[model samples]
Target: MEKKTYIQAFCTIENNKIVLNGETVFESENTGFADFSKKAYQHFEIGYPKFFKMDNLSKLAFLGSELLLKAQNPNDENNTALLFANKSSSLDTDVKYQNSISDKENYFPSPAVFVYTLANICLGEISIRHQLKSENSFFIFDAFNAAFMADYANILIETQKAKNVLCGWTEFFGEDYKAFLYLVGNEGAIENTKQNLEILYNK
Candidate 1:
């Protein structure tokens, strides 16, 4: 019998740096989903699917899923998505969507932009992209809550709602953006859990 080493992880934005898998890929320039997508495309070598550029939240969701899927246990199917965050709640798209309604000359809701008004849509996009149907939830908070995140994840696993969980905070502050994600599971490969999440935001 051996004590297992779990690798609980997170990605974040800081000092104009985009931290992903603990590596800084881009800097400054008001990075958002577009920047995230470009950097992700460069880093992963897999081009984004055809429709990513069509929507802001979809792009963010795609990026989050890409990171979480890499950390997921390939053998596990019972996985849940838990997201936490605050601010704007897709204000980026809301602004764009408003124009469609505001213009009396051709007032029409852009379904593309309208689809992202709810912050939780990001989760749906990710789930669909990954074919993940396990339990999923979204929470809005002023800051990251280590205790709540840990408890929720543990509950999901202990109750058999899922064997693994993808928990995260994804946000866009106008042109600026930040995202932190983790894969939590009973499997022996993830580490740090709540402590790792603290390091991400507290940094």
Candidate 2:
């Protein structure tokens, strides 16, 4: 079987910043991871209350889930999620988790804090949010490699396993974070070049 192709993508960063269909949805001051999570939810129109209460990984996942679903085909069920690349790795929540243990005389490990330790938890959080029961995988890359991403998406689609593959780079490094997601489908919008991807990222 031949591999499927890409349809649409939604990217966002710290401070209510967003890039939907290669366009900006919201732009604001970039800050620490927690604050970024709050601002990101607002961009998705999920309001502050609901946003603030969500766990760190949950927040990241929810934002990614919302973007992909918005661009999805209503009847599509053969979906897959493939998230790739880099840091902070729940550092914000980890700090809190460690603090909770040290600050208290009794010392208790927070289940919530422990959950966000793995980077893939973000993907799981998204899956739970969207009820996405398809295949999912996460990878860490030093930087966005368009070729590798394209190849991975192609493999999933060509296997006759998945009709759509949500692929991208989502990394959080301390005070900086970036999320770039593409809803890859057999039939949909196309961004067929590396230059194009780089161009979008640069802008």
Candidate 3:
């Protein structure tokens, strides 16, 4: 008999609020994603200095993953896979980098800003923090595809490629941003399914 997969924990961030496992952990009147992300890092007592240098997309995903990972505390780090997706595809940072070079008089392309032009940089940041070198991938869709994430994660687990999957949708652009991350493992309170993922994402 195959072991059934379950969602061990989840976190959602949006509208200047952070919710871990359905309970609000942090909230702020600061509507800006940068301010709210900084507040979240402070509130969680995160000591990662690199977090300060990340783009908004990376910050959003990092914070959400931090919340879920802290809750589950998975021991088999190398056996965990990261599956993340978004719609904007780093356009936020792309614009910033573009603007930096857009001025011919001030033609300066920041290496710091240029590195975050890829949406997968957030996954790299998270993987580096947790020392996770397992299977990972990032996708962009017209909208959140809960079904694809659920199926792909389960496939990895079923094939023994990974013991657990940390997956989510992190979207950030301009003044709008949202993050929904969940941990799927062999045991947990919620079964890992498309419907469950969609419900958690919507919540």
Instruction: Give the winner by TM-score.
Output: 3
Give the alpha-carbon lDDT of every model: 0.64, 0.65, 0.90
RMSD per prediction, one decimal? 3.9, 3.2, 1.5
Candidate 3 per-residue C-alpha lDDT over 1-203 given as tens digits, one digit per residue, 9 for 90 to 100: 25568998898999999988899989999758878888889999999999999999999999988887776555766789999999999999999999999899999998999999999999999999988999999999988898898888888899999999999899999988888999998888999888998899898
lDDT of residue 137 for candidate 1: 81
Candidate 1 has a TM-score of 0.79
Query: What TM-score does structure 3 among the candidates reach?
Result: 0.96
Query: Each model's TM-score, in the order given?
Result: 0.79, 0.79, 0.96
- Tell me the spans in candidate 3 whose CA falls farther than 4 Å from its real position: 1-3
How displaced is residue 67 in candidate 3, in Å? 1.1
lDDT pick, better of 2 and 3: 3
Q: Compose the digit string of candidate 2's lDDT tens values, residues 50-152.
A: 4455556556556766776766766774466554555456666677778878866879897856877677776676666666787787776668777677777
lDDT of 1 by residue, 2-85 (tens): 222243555665444656667775554545456656666566665546435446655655665676576666667446545455
Q: Candidate 2: where are CA atoms >4 Å away? A: 1-4, 29-36, 39-43, 47-53, 101-106, 191-195
lDDT order, best first, reads 3, 2, 1
lDDT for 163 in candidate 2 is 71
